[model samples]
Target chain A: MRIGELAERAGTTTRALRYYESRGLLPARRAVNGYRTYDEDDLRLLQQIRTLRDFGFELEETRPFVDCLRAGHPAGDSCPASLDVYRRKLAELDALIGQLDAVRTQVGAQLARAELEAGAALPGGPEPRCELTHNGPTD
Target chain B: MRIGELAERAGTTTRALRYYESRGLLPARRAVNGYRTYDEDDLRLLQQIRTLRDFGFELEETRPFVDCLRAGHPAGDSCPASLDVYRRKLAELDALIGQLDAVRTQVGAQLARAELEAGAALPGGPEPRCELTHNGPTD
Candidate 1:
C-alpha cells in the first residue's frame, strides 16, 4: 500500500514514517514511480519500532532491537543486547521519573494557587503523581 | 559574582545560564570585563524560573509571570495573560501525561514478554487476555 495507508495502518502519521525512514529505522525500496513500497516484514518492523519508541526508547537505542528482529532470531539465544538496552533505559526512566516528580510538585503548587484564586476545586480532583509530576506515586 | 558562583547559587550550570540569557529567559547587564552580575532580585527570579521550568513551563511561557513578578502585586491584578499561559500549559501537561502513559504500557509489555521468554513460561500466560502489540493505550 501507499505511505498514507501504511501510516494509517501503523497508527502513526505519514511525516513520522518518513522520518523513521530518514533516520534509517525503516528502509524502503523505492517504486518505479518513486513511491516507497513496504512488505509484510516492513509492517512488522514498523510496529516493533513504534512499540519501543512508545516505551521511551530513543530512536538510536531502538536500532539494536530492530537489527535483532531483522536478523532472524537464532533459536533460544538471549537478546542480551536488548536486555542491556532495557536496563539502561530503566535507569534513564528513573531519572526521568525524578524530573517528572519535580514538575508535579511545582505544578501542584501552581494548581493550588490557581484554585485559590478561582475559588473552586480543580476539575481533575487530584491527578496521579507520575514520573513527570508529583512526588507521590502513591498519591 | 562570577558566572560559576551565580550558577552554583542558582543550582544550575554556567552554560545553562548563558543558554538562558541567549534564549531571552535572562538578561545580563554585562560587566566591563565581559562577566555577568545578578542582583538579589535576579537571583530570586532565577530560582523562580527554574522552579517553573521544572514544572514544565517553557522559557517563553514564563514571560508574563516575570512581568507580573517585576510589577508587583498590583501588576498581578492587572495581567490575566499569565493565567491563560498557565491554563494552556496545564492542558499541555495533561497531553504529555497521556503520551507517557502510552509509553509506560509499551515498556510493561516488553518487560512481560522478556520475562516469559527468559523463564521458559508457556507460550500463553493465564489470560487477562492481553494483546496491544501496536494498538493504542491499553489504559
Candidate 2:
C-alpha cells in the first residue's frame, strides 16, 4: 500500500507516517514505480505505534515497542525492551499525577481563600474576626 | 533596580524576565543609561506570576493575575478578571487530572497484564490449563 492507504488503514495521517519514516521508525520501501510502499507487516507496525501513542506514550518512547514488533515478537510488550519502556512510562505518569495533585490542592486552597475574603468584604457582610486578638485583651 | 536585581529578588533568572518582557507580560522601563529598570511593584508582579506558574499555570494563564497586580489591586486574585482566570484554570486542571488518571489506570493495567503473561511464559512454568477441553470438546 501507499503512504495514504497505510495511513488510512492505520487511522493516522500520511504526514505522520512520513514523520515516523523520517525518525527511522516505520521505514517504507520504494515500489518499482518510485512511490513509497508498505506491506501488511508495516501495517501491523503502524498499529503498534498508534496504540502506544494513544496510550500517551511519547513518539521516542514508542521506539522500543516498534523495534520489538519489527523483531517478530508475539506482541510489543513480549520484549524486555518494550516492558522496560512501559515501566518507565508508568513511573513518569505517577510522578506527573503527584505533581498535578499537589498543584490542584494549592490552587483549590487559593481559590477558596480568595472567595472567602471577597465574600467577607461585601456590603452587610459578617464582621471580620481579628485572629491576632482572638484571645488577647483589646487595648 | 536593574534587570539582574529584579530577577534575583524574584528568585528567577534575567533571561526569564527578558522572555516575559518579550511576551509583553512584564515590560520594563529603560534607565537613562539604556539599562532596564524595575521597582518594588515590579517585584510583586513577578512574584504573583511566579507563584501561579509554580501552581502549574501557563505563562499566558498568569497574565490576568499580573494585570490585576499592575492595576493596583491588593492582590492578583482581587480582580474579577483574575478570578475568572482562576475558575478557568481550575476547570482546565481538573480535566487534565481526569485524563491523566484515566491514562494511569490504562498503563497500570497494561503493565500488570504484560507482567503476568511474562511470568506465565517463564521456563519450567506451571502446566497450561485447558479450559475448552475441560468443558468438553467443541462440536
Candidate 3:
C-alpha cells in the first residue's frame, strides 16, 4: 500500500508515519519511484504504535517493550518486569490525581472566601479575585 | 541583585530568569560589560510568577492576572473571574488524570495477561496476546 493508504488504515497522519519510520518504530520499503510502500503488516504495527503512545509510553519507553516481543515473549521470565512498569505508571497517575485534588480544594476555598468577604460591610472596595477573562494572548 | 541572589529570592534558576526574559516574561537591563540587573520589585514579580506557575497557570496565562494586579489590584473587579480560570485548569487536569488512569488499566491488563500465559509460552514463539503488543514485526 502507499503511504496515504497505510496512514488512513492506521488512522494516523503521513507525517507521523514518517516520524515513526525515522524512530525505528516502523519500517517501509522504498518503491521504484522513491516513494515508501507499506503492507498490511505495517498497518497493524502502526496501529500498535498509536495504541502504545495513547497509553503514554514515550517512544523511548516503547523500545524495550518492542524488544520484549521480539525476543520470543518469555512468559514468566520477563513478566515481572513488565508488571513493575505498569505499577510505576499507575503511581504516576495517582500523583497527578493528587495534584488535581489539591487544585480542586484550592478552588473551593477561593469561592467560599469570595462569598464570605462579599457579604461583609467593612471594606473600602469589594475583595479582589482571579478571573479567567481574555484567556491571555494566543500568539 | 546579582543573578544568583535574584534566583534565590525568586526560587528559580538564573537560567530560568534569562529564559523568562527571552520569552518576554521578564525584563532585564544589562549593566556595563554584561551582568543582568533586577530590583526588589522585579524579584517580587518573579516570585509571583513562580507562585502562579505552581498553581497551574502557564506563563501566557499569567498575563491577564498580572494585568489585573497592575490595574491597582481592582478590589472585586477581576479576581472573581480568576476562580473561573482555576476551575477550567482543574478540568484540564482532571482530563489528563483520566487518561493516565486509562493507561494504567491497559498496561496492567496487558501485563497480567502476559504473566498468566507465560506458563505455556514457547521459547521462540510470539505470545500473540492482545492489540497492544501483537502488531509487531514478528507477526
Candidate 4:
C-alpha cells in the first residue's frame, strides 16, 4: 500500500506516517516507480506505533516497540525493551499527575481567596467579623 | 531600574522580561543612555505575571492580570477582568486534570495487563489455569 492508504488504514495521517519514517521507526521501501511502498507487515508496524502514540508515548519511546515488531515479535510489548518503555511511561504519567494535582490545589485556593476578598470589598458591604474582633479588644 | 534588576526582583530572567515586552505585556521605557528602564511598578507587574505563570496560566491569559495591575489596582486580581481570567483558568485546569486522570487510568491498566502477560510467558512457568481448562475439554 501507499503511504496514504497505510495511514488511512492505521487511522492516522500521512504526515504522521512520514514523521515516523523520518525518525527511522517505520522505514518504507521504494517501488520501481520511486514511490514509497509498504506491505501488510509495514501496516502492522504502523498500527503498533500509532497505538503507542495514542497512549501518549513520545516518538522516541515508540522506537523499541517498532523494533520489536520488526524483529518478528507477535506483539509490540513482547520484548523486554518495550516493557521497560511501558514502565517508564507509567512512572512519567504518575509524576505528571502529581504535579498537576499540586498546581490544581494551589490554583483552587488562590481563586477562592481572591473571590472572597473581592466580595468583601464591595461598596457598603458589612464589615467582616475578623475586622470587628481585631478592633474590639487587646488582651 | 534596569531590565536585569527588574527580572531579578521578580525572580525571573531578563530574557523572559524581554519576551513579555515583545508581546507588549510589559513594555519598558528607554533611558537617556538608550538602556531599558523600569520602576517598582514594573516589578509588581512582572511578579504578577510570574506568579500566574507558575500556576500554569498561559502568557496570553496573564495579560488581563498585568493590565489590571498597570491600571493602578492594588493587586493583579483586583479587577473584574482579572477575575474573569481566574474563572477561565480554573475551568481549563479542571478539564486538564480530568483528562490526565483518564490517561493515568488507561496507562495503569495497560501496564498491569502487559506485566501479567509477561509473567505468564516466563520460561518454565507453570501452566495458566485457563490453559489447563482448554486442554481438559479437548481431552
Top model by DockQ, which number? Answer: 2
Candidate achieving the largest lDDT: 2
Ranking by TM-score: 2, 4, 3, 1
lDDT of each: 0.66, 0.79, 0.63, 0.75
lDDT of 2 at B68: 83
Itemize residue pairs with steric clashes in candidate 3.
Answer: A75-B118, A129-B79, A130-B79, A130-B81, A130-B82, A131-B81, A131-B82, A132-B81
Instruction: Report the TM-score for the A-chain of model 4.
Output: 0.85
Ranking by lDDT: 2, 4, 1, 3
* Candidate 3 lDDT (Cα, 0 to 1): 0.63
Q: What is the Å distance of residue B138 in model 2 from its true position?
A: 41
Better of 1 and 2 by TM-score: 2
Candidate 3 error regions (>4 Å): A68-85, A107-139, B1-4, B18-41, B74-78, B120-139
Better of 1 and 3 by lDDT: 1
Mind sharing the TM-score for model 3?
Answer: 0.69
Per residue, candidate 1 scores C-alpha lDDT tens digits across B1-139 of 7778888897889998898889777787778988887787777667766666656667788777677667673322124677777667666656666666556555655666675575553565542333545554322
Residues A77-138, model 3: lDDT tens digits: 25455556656666776776676666656645654665556455256565554552222211
CA shift of A96, model 2, Å: 0.4
- Looking at model 1, the pairs that clash are A100-A131, A100-A132, A100-A133, A104-A133, A104-A134
Alpha carbon lDDT at B19, candidate 3: 84
Measured against the true two-chain complex, the DockQ scores of the candidates, in the order shown, are: 0.16, 0.30, 0.22, 0.28
The full ranking of all candidates by DockQ, starting with the best, is 2, 4, 3, 1
Task: Give a tens-digit lDDT track for model 4, residues A1-139.
Answer: 8988998998888999888888888888999998899999999888777666666777899899889888987677768898898788878877876777777676666667767777888875853432100111011
Choose 2 or 3, whichever is better by lDDT. 2
Per-residue accuracy of model 2 over A1-139 as CA lDDT, tens digit each: 8999999998889999999999999988998988999999999888888877877788898898889888887677777888898889888888887777776676776777777777877866764432211111111
